[model samples]
Target chain A: MVESKHSWKAWLYLAPAIVLLLVFTVWPIINTVRMAFLDDYSGLEEVGGTVFNFGVGNFIKVVQYQRFLDCLKTTSILCIATVPISTILALLIAVALNSIKVLQKFLQTVFFLPYVTNSIAIGMVFAAMFNIVGSFLGTENELVVTAGVINNVIEFFGGTHVNWINVGSTYAANIFVMVVYIVWNALPFKILILLGGLQSINKQYYDAAKVDGTSKGRILRKITVPLLSPMLAYVVITGFIGGFKEYTSIIGIFGETMGPADASGRLNTMVGFIYDALASNKQGRASAAALILFGIILVVTLINLQVSKKKVHY
Target chain B: MADNNIVVMHERQMNKVKTASKVGGVAGKVLTYLFLTIMALIILFPFYWMIISSLKTLDEYRMSVPTFWPRVVMFSNYAEAFTVGKLGRLFLNTVIVGLVSTLLSLVITVISAFAFARLEFKGKNILFAGLLATMMIPGELFTITNYGTVTSLGWKNTYTVLIVPFLVSVFYIYLLRQNFLQIPNELYLAAKVDGTSDIKYLWKVMIPLALPTLISITILKMTGAWNSYIWPRLVANDGVHSLITNGLRNAFTETTGDVNYPVQMAAVALVSAPLFIVFIFLRKYIMKGVSRSGIKG
Candidate 1:
């Protein structure tokens, strides 16, 4: 390619972003790959040496780690469960909001409120809403009650009172609480995006259908559903991507512990597990886990792009 | 007489149908509003609960049946949050980090966006495409190595650790670049013919044209800094250095004694109020920013 004469000035302008990107993004990725291939780099600093095993040992260790597997399962369950539920709910909300004449902006602002608040802070509120704990330091730690609205409803429906937060053999109840929180948190953005998509649709389509005396359900199915596919795809892809990295909300509800401890006392998500590994000087394992997560995200995103290309109307 | 009677009957039937449809229209509007109001209440309830719980006393907060509103409003809880949780320091730290990083990041983003948009350089497309590819990779991957780099640099517990890594966002650069491209190249050429420097032309002309996108970036970046928890918690989750979000993790909890849930809720409320106010007032900018990112709706 013929280079521009102004390449010098352009480089000057691009220097800051390039430098920061190299340090923070590019170099870190290279380092992660290198570390993931090697053994743990613990104590190498003191010895002024480097570890270079350069095998699949780290990957093997990551897959074999029970906590990592559990964390992956938890993450997958959350992603699979929340993404569709939230997308459908958001789509419905958006369609309703779009049809409305009054208080649309007001409702929009209310929905978007969750997007602005810190996840951890809101997670705390959600955690408290789901359970009523006994007095701190009380010997009657067993005196915990189902103070949360959802658990109370469950109790009313002839279901036994369960510690929703501290999930035991039944992971369903705990997963349910997590899904609800995530769905609520995810709604505002998805709704906003879907609303935008719905609004972008031309009025002529609806008018033509109305002239033909098309029912509301038919109009939505024939007109709204096809046109809104692009946004719906976008929401699903991003939502799934976000769901995989689930960390802070868990921390918000369960403190730094992430969730209620299992038999091994490991309540980790994918990101949380990575953080824990890195913190505890298990650099190789952390890097491997991170790289695995990256691969999954990349695959999921690519698959979504491919699927949407076939399905999305525009 | 028969023809006249048929005409009257048709007219009556048409009028009745019109009246039924009119009533249905009114009912539909009412139903729409009813649905919206219920959803709005559900969406807004957590924020309401946060504020009310903050105002309740310890006993009221832990009641067998939660009160919809506080029995007694504890205004002192706010004061207690400030002093007891050292929220004043956390607020200051958060504000400093947010403002400084946002301003610095803006400078980098504007210049880089200008280069990619207006300036023609070798491999410009390739470089930009490479950067775009990085967006596909989840950011958690970077934290793995960036944490090690920061710790090695002895930047832990320092503002440098908190602010430096995140000061450049590829997405923001891409957004500003798109915005800058909309400004005609003729203006830049016209200024260049006058012997104006690139930086001078940028300051005097490009910035004014792209002011809306610039404002969007600033507000979003600031809000991002305000809401950041995990990274800050990882590197600087210590006294004075802790961000407001990280600081609230367990600041109001009793270390070895009874925990006052109300007081902690008060701390959360304190941390949340600024963002809520910002969201309310500058919502247009935030909404516009998202819409402009080519992800409209």
Candidate 2:
């Protein structure tokens, strides 16, 4: 009898969360899959209780869209480029931080400063850094204005200023700016996790290595890397998941166009594609694209797990 | 005599080795500090740049060559950004959404976590597992449908739209549930023996024990609200319901399609200030919350 009473009380406690979750979480997952299969089901049209036929037309349409392909390519490229670069850099920095005795806390705090920052705000700052102040009026009659701070630095180093994130800016230049920003944003969390992992490691392992007169490089390569593998794996997996969802940073740097002037949507990612679809009231296509992105993330995560299983020391 | 000579030679070699290692250690320490300092400056450079740019005159900002420091310090630019951006309104909306959503979410999280941790509910394990499974699915999937749901429900341009859809975070529930489980069950049993209700036991004992995690959750939730962009941009982009981010984004652009760079920078600086202050003061809670979630923005 007491057990039954407790069960009822538990249900009462769970009532609010359950109701919200049913509406927001459970229904959405089912609805995303439902809408993905529907043939161009507009949310606005659904208000009239229009019965839509179920098919894979939405998915087919999304796949055939060139911009969607471009989004996939951008998302993949970003994930491929930023994850390993940030993870390795973070590892090196964390190991260096662990070895140091002076100003370690101060440096750690400084490095983690970006973690608390608003990305949109910081993206604007970066945009200013790489932004050109003057206008490009005509094809041949280009008005030379102030190059951004970064270009100024390049000019100082005897290198010509490259047009970055401007009209006629190369895809390579835009991607470079984005890679720098993403890596900068990614570093702090990776460092924190790895540093926490490093601290928990047995000091006696280092003591033994010291007594053995082991070279520092050798010890790091042979001992530190293995012990730190689990944290590294976690960081890499999460980095990829986060990287695949890249959207707002582009908005911050390039405004809602998602790219440089006159090259709008050139740097659009999967999430951006879905947003565009949704804004155009193409719920069917948006849901299809969302499912596709989810599928990609799931596959990539599984691959990460398999790879880590083989390679991770833990 | 030969043995004594060998001993002296060995001593000399050892001294040379010791000095070399000592020099190597010092050099390594120097290199470490140098690397850290450079990295620190690089990490902090954007913030430095944001501040200086915010202070620069428009003419100086647009000069053919960038000025490292502004020739004319424009303190008035802040005032301009503030009024033009309607930052006061945005700040109020953000605070209202952040505080209301956080408080409500905390209540839901606590009760749900209590049920999961301490109660004898049927299918509790399965229900909890179902919630955890939702975490793996990218949030965009839900967002697409939620947008439709909210729009159909006539929740546009309302605080209810911002707060209601995101009230029950599975991660927070899981986090708090883990925290609740750490408390000894004997306390609950004793409370029960004394005819204490579950809610009373939760308030007096469980909440106090889990105060740190609760604090962490509150800070994270509030910051999450403050930093939210895409959702608010979609559902509530009008002047009446605009959040800080969307307001700042379009606030300083002129009719000619040119952004007033310095004023925009000022707006961004003002927008970032509260978060920076929160971080400096409640950094432990924020970090704890972040590390626990392992979810990056």
Candidate 3:
């Protein structure tokens, strides 16, 4: 009777959150699936009381679209390329920071700086670093400009300046720039998590290794990595999920184009594809694309979990 | 005598090994520091560049070789960026949205958390599990339908649109619930025996005990408002309702397709200042909130 009395009061307390969640979250999820199945469904037309046939038309359209394929490819390449590289780099950095006592806190704070930054703002800063500032010189408007800081640094190192995200830049070059920016943005949080994991690890293991005269490399591989596997798995799984949804970082660099001016949609990811569809009022297609992305993330996450379960040591 | 000689030789060999190991350890430490210093520089360079680039003149900024430091520092660019980007208005809008949404969300979170934490609710376990499951689905999926929902409601170009839909963050509710549960059940039971009302008890005891988590939630929610771009861009991107992130996007590009790099950088720097300040002052809370959630994606 007491518990029953509290039930209604609990409902009262939960009313506001539940109401908003139902409208905004639960309904939206169901509506996304519903809209995805509705062939050629326009939200505007639906509001005007137009009935729509339900079919696989939207999914078919999303699959057949060339831009969507490009988005899929871009997303996959980014995920594959970035996750391993960032994970390894962050692992090494975290381990190094863990080993050292000198300036450890300072370096950790510095490394964690990007975690607090606005991605768009930092993305713009990255864009400027790689951007070529040009001026139209003659009547023909031949562009003359200064190389960006990245290019200047390359030249200083006796390498030629490459057009990174500019017009006429190669796909590989553009992807390279995006990878660098993504990795830079990703490092701080990973370092934070891994460092925390490293710190919480017992010192007895290291002391035992030292007594046995174990080499640093062997200890890192055999002891440190196995102990830190759980955090690494978490980071890698989250990294893939985040990489699939890569949008704002691209927006920060390329504005709304998602690519260089001459090559719009070249660097577009799955989320960007959905956004483009929504922007054009292709709600059904956008929903389908979003579902596709969700499916991919689900499959990937499951695979990651399976692999981690087998390989991760406790 | 031969055994003594063997012992002396063994001791000499051990000393040599000890010296070698000591040297190796020093070298390892030096290498670690060197690597960390370089990584730190790589991380910090963009910020340094953003500052220097913001201070340079347009001509200087466009020079074939980028200047490590601006030859002529342009202090007026910040003023120009402030007016040109209409940063003041954007700042005002962001503050309004951030505060209103954070406060309202806090109330909802506290009450909902209390309910889930203490009150014997039917279907409580299922409801909490369902909420946690939603964290797996990408938020972009929601945007597709929510855009339609908001548009049908005629929420375009309004602060209400910006503040209302995001008022119920399942993550914050979950975070606060965990915090509320940490308050000993004895206190609640004692209050109940004394005929104290649940809401009154929650307000007086639970909230004060869970202040740290509440504070963390507030900071995280405020920062979320500051960093949010996608949803706001979808529904309320007009001049009046646009938040700072959307406001800064495309604000500096000229009609000729040339961006004013210096002024844009200055605008970015200004836009980023508050977040950096918040981070510097409230880093512990922010970090605690982030690490606790671990679902930022």
Please, what are the lDDT tens digits per residue for candidate 2 over residues B164-200? Answer: 9999999999999999999998998899889998889
**Backbone clash count for every predicted candidate, in the order shown:** 3, 0, 0
Per-residue lDDT, model 1, residue B29, is 76
Deviation in Å, model 1, residue B179 alpha carbon: 0.6
Name the lDDT value of residue A167 in candidate 3. 75
TM score of chain A per candidate: 0.89, 0.95, 0.95
Evaluate all candidate structures by whole-model CA lDDT and list the values in order.
Answer: 0.79, 0.88, 0.87
Task: Name the top lDDT candidate.
Answer: 2
* Model 1 chain A: worst 10 consecutive residues (lDDT sum): A258-267
- Candidate 1 lDDT, B1-297, residue by residue in tens: 999997687567556655756766688778878887888888887778778888988877766666778989998988988888888888999899999999999999989999899888879899999999898887778998888788889999999898899888899899988888888888888887888888899999989988988888888877777788878878886675898877787574321112466677788888888887887788898887875553211
Q: Which lDDT tens digits does candidate 2 get at residues A211-267?
A: 567898999898898898899899999999999999988888888888886888999
Q: Which ten residues in a row have the lowest lDDT in candidate 2 chain A?
A: A133-142
Docking class of 2: acceptable
> Which prediction has the highest DockQ against the true structure?
3
Better of 1 and 3 by TM-score: 3
Q: Compared with the real two-chain complex, what DockQ does model 3 have?
A: 0.49
Against the true structure, what is each candidate's TM-score? 0.91, 0.94, 0.94
Candidate 3 clashing pairs, residues 3+ apart or interchain: none
